[model samples]
Target: MSFDSFLSQIKSKASELKTDVLKFKNKDFLNAAMAGSALIAMADGSVSAEEKQKMLKFIEGNEALSVFSTSDVIKAFSDFIGQLEFDKDIGEAKAYQALGKMKNNVEAARLLIRMIIAIAAADGSFDVTEKKVAQKIAQELGLNPADFEL
Candidate 1:
């Protein structure tokens, strides 16, 4: 192959890889958001509309987050929530498991910790339930819960 042709092929391959990376990153956030919602829902028996709004707003406003459609996010949360609503074990463990998945990615791990803290503080008051769940999550994420001070 000629030099220019080789360079063009390399560039095209790089672009393809970048697009794949972006897609993976987006899917990760979708899963992470599902986990976050699970955590919020389990902190109490029911997930309130106001609470859902707060979480969605936070995700949308995050500088690093992608612009996911409301329906997409709702679907992930709904599926998890639906499972948890009737199934006993799903809700309680979902967020914790998700947090574990992101542990190797330091940035994602830190963000997840911050999110749990934010969710714990969402209702204008942090209670024992939120504190306990958040603490467990912090531990699972290998973060210092005291640093987050939930």
Candidate 2:
């Protein structure tokens, strides 16, 4: 009940609130990024270990997405993968729905496209199927595929 103790409690609560606010603000971006990663990872008809590693690295390194913990990113990516595994068509629809959320934010959309491209090429080869998927993602974001040289 001391004044110092009360001040400490308020500070702790404020810090927690800030963290929550940050997570909320970035949730959409995280989902979209993971969605795109899943799409591209599956473009080759399989999700390779290399692709997943690249995605984790990219998200961890990126300033905007670095706020998220590894577990959060992994969960988001796994959710997309699970959807894709259960049903291809439905999974794609949902992934596109997530990407569509960023359609209006050109900067975020561009970053997402870049992230997916990096993931696709992570296995040392960017195949035709992967490029096609990336193109679709770019279009979903209301961006020009050629802009990213897709």
Candidate 3:
């Protein structure tokens, strides 16, 4: 499917799973989601303007995370990016640690993976770096990369 249609389907599916999404709206979930987004976005060393914009739009529009204020979401994403900019190895370790929090929650982990993939593909090119990062995320989540066709 096209990116727009894929995104639309994700949103619709999220709405259908509102209860599950709501339960995952806690600080840990937000942190993991933001960290995952940052990791995928920075897989190639930098995030494109379009990728950033599309990610923000997806976060804002996603029904599951709509409970958060726009500023809060922005802050979460920025905080992760700031850490990465400061130190690559350390920052990635920290980010992956955050993502590791969702490892036990299969549902949340899957959703997080999908969201990160969407962000990586937002620029219309899911490159090798992004795919590798995503594969690592899948392993961290106790999932298989093949499930996402990575």
Candidate 4:
């Protein structure tokens, strides 16, 4: 192929790759992230307003998650919280199922565990309950809790 044609082809391929990467930041990943965070937030009995605000701030500040809009993030987080408020067992099961989506990707799983830990400690108190929740999340992600010092 000619030089110009090759360059155009490369650009088109790059665009395709960019679109694929963007797909990873869709509602499925957002829902999983919010569910995991909500589980951790509720570990200590209830999710305080401060904890919610802190989680929202972290989500907004996170580069990987920033691809999504703030309203979408809030809605996902709220939906998970609502599920938990409605039924504990069902909520936890649903959250775990969401988190399971990241189990096959080591890097993503690790990042998720770290995010959960950060959320758990957001209120300045990472208690035993929170740690247990983090550990559970680690397990659900097919990772070792010890890796994150959980």
Which candidate tops lDDT?
A: 3
TM-score per model over all chains: 0.66, 0.74, 0.82, 0.77
Candidate with top TM-score is 3
Point out the worst 10-residue segment of candidate 3 by lDDT. Answer: 14-23
Clashes of 1: 0
lDDT comparing candidate 4 with the true structure: 0.79
Cα miss at 31, model 1 (Å)?
A: 1.3
Q: Which 10-residue window of candidate 4 scores lowest in summed lDDT?
A: 13-22
Better of 1 and 2 by TM-score: 2
| Candidate 2 lDDT tens digits, 19-107 | 53354458898899889988987886766677667766765554445567878888998899889989989999999999999999887
Worst 10 residues of 2 by lDDT: 16-25
Q: Candidate 3, residue 141: CA error in Å? A: 1.0
lDDT score, candidate 3: 0.85
Q: Rank the candidate models, highest lDDT first.
A: 3, 2, 4, 1
Off by over 4 Å in 3: 1-11, 17-19, 48-54
By the lDDT metric, which is better: model 2 or model 4? 2
| Per-candidate count of clashing residue pairs (backbone under 3 Å) | 0, 0, 0, 0
